[model samples]
Target: MNLLPAYVLLDLETTGATPARDRITEIALIRYENGEEVARWQTLVNPHMPIPPFIQTLTGIGDDMVQAAPDFESVAPRLYQYLDGAVLVAHNVRFDHGFLKHEFQRIGIILRQKVLCSVKLSRLLYPQHRSHGLDAVIQRHQIVVAARHRAMGDVEAVAAFIEAAGRELGEDRVALEVARLMTAPSLPPGLDPSLLDELPETAGVYLFFGADDAPLYIGKGVNLRSRVLAHFSGKTTDMAQAVRRVEWLETVGEFSALLLESHLIKTRQPLHNSLQRRQRQLCAWRLAAAPDIHPQAQLVREDAIDPTALGDLFGLYRSRKHAEEALRGIARNHALNPRLLGLESGDVRASSEPDAQHYLRLKLALAAQRLKDWPYPGKIAVREYDATSQRTQLHVFEHWCYLASVDNEADLHDVLAQRSTPVFDLDIYKLLQQVLLPPAKTGAKPAIGGLEIVHFQDGYDQQKTSSSSQ
Candidate 1:
């Protein structure tokens, strides 16, 4: 009921919109007790996903920036302590609170705390104004934010907004409004409610668990903080429920996070994640044999294809339904034969009508948009570094699929030489296809065959001369 009793001002940077699909990148919380700044905390979390180019540009938190930050598990306790027994306050409190609640829920903890949204308060008090967002509030109050979009600056802005509104609108009005917004939502009994400061802004995946360490959900994002918060803050009902514990995995790049998130969701099969796509259902439209020998219908996957080669292939789909739907649409629009195209269950017929020719033209146009050839040949690798662990890893792939991920060059070579052909994953294949297209240009560089495949056992790989056998 007492709105100002030990308030923790919080801000979070996250990956994307869907909490179950994104992760936290950074956290900043400033705790105030009796109207004084008592403590400050911050962290960069590996969200385990590629920061969308736009988000990275806006937040200035890129894949390279959080390369060394710790994962959420390592930083959670300190954050919990800071936010313990405090009212939560933020510009858009929904975003901050939702992320915290969801993240904590994943780690087997439930969090319920009084939340005060400055946006609501600002709107209520300034009824004439149309905007109540952070930027709007900062402009209205003439508050100078040392940094914009970053977690700490935003949290500080909220604190400033609260202080300014209290002065201009009177303490009673501000207090009452804060009290109204401070209603702590119901949470599962097992979680902890607290403010977190300075979580890293990195790409990675996060997980939530319920009672007895049961996984509830798994997600990936560019910014772990923002994505995790969206879950609890008036977004999706399913994300808010079924989470009791918070857990996360930090990844070096978006590719790693994407792969990891898919694998974890399948293996853990968290309750909250049940509605998510199943691995078996994941599919892609590989350009196989068209029913017509000359004029082919766009081939859809009759069965699953190896995902690693997905980059080599094209038209990746998460399920048969998706692939078929797309193909059917193409068939109808192009006037291609349904039976021939495999959209319908019947004999193949090559349409000879002028309408059919137009349809084929249209179908080719559509396929061109969706088709993506494999980017890399044989094996290629991307490197990831852990700031906290002070380690770097090389994620290796071949035929548009991952064979193995290794820490050292020796391991990379061993994986390359000894690793068996990876089973096909529609998701991974799609991912590789997306990443590998438009092969890297080698202007004056040596030809592919002349390029040496270096395998350094104790350290990094060495680009040695190619053997005469090649």
Candidate 2:
């Protein structure tokens, strides 16, 4: 009764965090059979790319060190042999597993192995401990290590922790924990496990497709792989079973993910995403600007609404009926006459109050739902960057409407050149309000901070915009 029949304690150092885009720079693993050490292997992989300066400082694996080493394709076969039929053991196993899977796929070899994460094991055995990262584990167990961030050093450290756990918790207790972790949740028969392996654990939106390429669901997540896998964990739903293909678009941050998810759900109209489906009859209350008007509220359809007059717009409703019902409720709550508000057909004099007082009450009741005007004088871009992947997305906006999201500054001119009349979207409006508007209370910070707002006044000037952004 060993922890596992056979397992390979492994670790990897990569050029970056994203597996699909980044390459592996180094790998190390020690294989065990029947609780006895069997084989040990390590290699420096030439990623064929420049390693970031920070990564070089962190892992001490610079371009010069790996320039002379064998590339991943050259080492794939032997690495596969070492990992064959072995439970992959590593600290934060998904990171290592994702990189390995992507690298192997590049060489036309599929690498699949049962993974056991040492971090999870640490948590299970030591529930009282709040930290389970490698640094934390090393400090707790007093494990000796020749190196810290290097691949072989980390692999050795993790193996030492596992051995120490077995001794302290007893072999049987450790074995039980290992067994519990080894039993991975099964995936649907229609879906390929490799697809899940290829998913990057980053902010992104994912789409599930059923037969004939019909979209079953569209969703966004801060960690795409973990969120997608959670769907198939305990019990597979009918929608999950119908999912035959999976696709994803990675974003720099959750903000972009939310925007993209909202856009896709409305446009694609996925069968299971009924809540976010497009509202064909979307309407909002447009308060009358004229002073002498009796019933001051009017319902305007989405196509007829003016983006420039957002300040006058009140609550967004799915249909004309919903807008009427909401306004009726507002009138009732404010003690205003529904007949004067145009909810009912009657003589204006029949109302108990004067026209001015009734209009004031109507405006006061709808003040909370009033849409905020665009704060900027012109079009602005909210830039989001992922430091790990070096990915950047610039979301351009004007009058609370999303113009376009571009990856580079070079495309900004084209977006401006092709810019058409900004059609206001209720979802995009709400999102921008949440992210960009100032806090309601005086002297309070906004909901989201550290946003890089670049202004495009007269036109898109690359140099000026670049300097201004900096």
Best by lDDT: 2
Candidate 2 yields a Cα-based lDDT of 0.83
Stretches of candidate 2 off by over 4 Å are 127-130, 193-196, 416-418, 439-470
lDDT scores in order: 0.65, 0.83
* Candidate 2 Cα deviation (angstroms), residue 214: 1.5
TM-score of 2: 0.89
Question: By summed lDDT, which 10 consecutive residues of candidate 2 come out lowest?
Answer: 461-470
State TM-scores per candidate: 0.50, 0.89
Residue-wise C-alpha lDDT for candidate 1, range 1-470, written one tens digit per residue: 22486988888888764455567899999998877788998888887678888778878899887778887767888988887888778876766766777788788877766666677788888999998878889999999998898999888888888778878988788888776655544454555554232223456898877667877778998667557766766544755665666666766555567878988877788776665556466555544443234334344452546444443344656667777787777667765566555566754444455544544564464656454444443566655444422445666666655677776766655676665755665556556544443334322232211122222333333433222112
Per-residue lDDT of model 2, residues 382-443, tens digit only = 77777656777888888888989999888888887775899888888878776664323323
Count: clashes, candidate 1: 68
Prediction 1 TM-score vs. true: 0.50
In Å, residue 287's CA in model 2 sits off its true spot by: 2.4
Identify the runs in model 1 with alpha carbons over 4 angstroms from their true place.
1-188, 194-203, 222-226, 234-239, 253-255, 274-276, 279-314, 318-322, 342-371, 386-391, 440-470
